[model samples]
Target: MKNNPVNTDLPLFCPREGCVCYQSYDNKITKDGIYITKSDMVPRQMFYCHGGGHRFSETGYSELFGKHGSFKEYEQAAKLSTYGISANATADVLGRDVRTVEQWQKALGSKGQQLHYFLCLHIGINVLFLQMDELWSYFKNKSRQLWVFIALESETKFWVSFELGSRTICTACRLVKGLRRLGKWGDDHILKVTTDKSAAYKNALANIMGDIQYAYLQIVKRRVKRRLVTVKKFFVKGMAEDFSEKLRTPPLLRD
Candidate 1:
């Protein structure tokens, strides 16, 4: 004789952007009894209610963890997946494949590229505050390093030029290219550029600003506490004395 199993119920989550709450339901019924389960038991396809009516279909879920799949499911898994939790651990908890976890990471990378593009395209304003910093990544075992150079208006916070770079020269070049892209590369456009005492930055600034006969600019170096010798500041005083008056005030906030 064949042994029969009992019926079952499962819990489900709405794989939407900002939805919460789990609904419980019965999955199957058999000779034994009933059992419960979760909705994320499988990949959920979502749909939108377009037009004036409520019509929904299996569209797709945003890659909260990756390019596609349930956002909540991945988030739930990510929290556990880190701190030495194996991929299998997360997969089992979320009822997903270990491969899916990797895919999510890839999707996040793609999104970062998109953000970088946007930061480059939209830049405006009078003053620019360029900063260089690094972000640490545990998975890569190395820091995700970058130089963020931006040309921004001091008052309105409008960005004129922004670039993310891996190399100092590349970063400097991007700063130049970004300014050119906004049609603000001329001598009169830049009021001041505050930066650290990087030789690449100094060389790049001189290359760009020195060409103009009318633009006066200064490069101020913020000192590191532990360093004994303070870094020297670089400035290009152009022919225009009127714009030079605005150079006295420091652009960055004191920390």
Candidate 2:
């Protein structure tokens, strides 16, 4: 029984995602005594709903669980991992198996990703002003390099979409495509996209912004040694101008 029990004062809905129980649905859930565990003699709460014959437990969805550890242990394992503690250390601290901690971490991560996607789906059309950037990281001993392309809605400061791949034109295209699917662009619906001076950015924006109304610009920072540097703007798309003219009006350069 290594499942995290949800602390709830009321059985809000059927734990099953496919269940059609309404909030107003009369689910007279009655407690059917308890089952005492043989090992610890801990009494587990059991519930039964007459509607749909839905039966569940306090520590589980539809049955008694948590044979090994409780939800607190699962939460502790998750928090330990978040605090820069490795899986082995988290397991040692929680007195749980290392593999169990790892599995909980993965499940929590997947739930977080699902929540993020759910929030993204609820973002209205008002979310505009796109910012694109790449984060470079290595796996384990730097054996495999991973490039994460992140697109942010600058105005709302909300994450639009992200893609994991090598820093390439195809990856950039995929990232842009992900952002474009979020909302409509062009004409009355304006979008200002800002990014660093990466060739992939140019290719991606050019390929996507053919009919869309968007202003794209690259922020170019000229480095002198390892000290402070000067910044300039390079126009990419939505508006056409000579390189010299584009540099003159930095404020007007960005859409």
Candidate 3:
């Protein structure tokens, strides 16, 4: 197949933060030329920012910037890494050095974090029901225990917030505070929360969500030798009968 000509319809802007037209939609950017790299043998489009007197490529501010490899190769490595494949195994599958895969993974992870913050931070959403939980993990060795506290919106199953720390009330408070910042609820709207039988969550919700009208439930599970015996539920804040009625006919399902 023949190489396609550059499309001028793309929304290009000055990426330099100090530039006058940074992120502006004005017609201050123009195509400079095309450059071909040996690694991918593909032509990359370059542009000039007249407002900032800066020059950059199409891949500027991206994870693939200044990377010497095919885009498909980097994408495949990221996909494999997400599937729990080790960097060494990914290098063997792609016929590349393990160090290169590791570098790509780090770069991709940084870019992912930036994107996630840009999209999720302070962007409030309507959350009626939320569930809080924690997962135990370790770093380097089993002795160094770590916990991941997570809050999920029950109806949409969207991850509202998370914190990495010890399984303490401090971490739980941070998680709930983040949820408060990201959720939009009115005084009349009663936010329902469910969590395991952890006193930390109880204190956190009570402290951080005191002003908001909400219902809290704790699920207690009895286990003998890792085998479940009985399960019980307790309401800590709102009335149990009201909470159960709301659960049976959730706000989203109401006519």
For model 3, the superposed segments whose C-alpha errors exceed 4 Å read 1-13, 24-36, 41-45, 121-124, 185-188, 222-229, 241-255
Q: Model 2, range 11-84, lDDT digits (tens) per residue?
A: 44445444555333466666867876543345777766666577666655422244455556656766877687
Identify the superior model by TM-score, candidate 1 or candidate 3.
Answer: 3
lDDT (Cα, 0-100) at 222 in candidate 2: 61
Model 2 gets an lDDT of 0.66
Q: Which stretches of model 2 miss by more than 4 angstroms?
A: 1-51, 56-85, 92-95, 123-125, 155-157, 183-188, 222-228, 239-255
Return the TM-score for each candidate structure. 0.41, 0.64, 0.75
Using lDDT, rank the candidates from best to worst. 3, 2, 1
Better of 1 and 3 by lDDT: 3
Over the stretch 1-255, how does candidate 3's per-residue lDDT look in tens digits? 023453335477787676788888784899999987766667888999987888888778677677666778878988998898999999999998988888889988887765555446533356777878888878779999999898877766577788999989999999998777764654567888888889999999889888878888886666687666776888887778646654632222101
lDDT of 1 by residue, 39-155 (tens): 334544433222212222332243342234555655665566446576677677667777886676556545555454544543322233333222222333446555456555544
lDDT of each: 0.47, 0.66, 0.77
| C-alpha RMSD of each candidate structure in angstroms | 15.7, 8.7, 7.7
In terms of lDDT, which candidate is strongest?
3
TM-score of 3: 0.75
**Candidate 2 lDDT trough over 10 residues, lowest sum:** 246-255
Which has the higher lDDT value, candidate number 2 or candidate number 3? 3
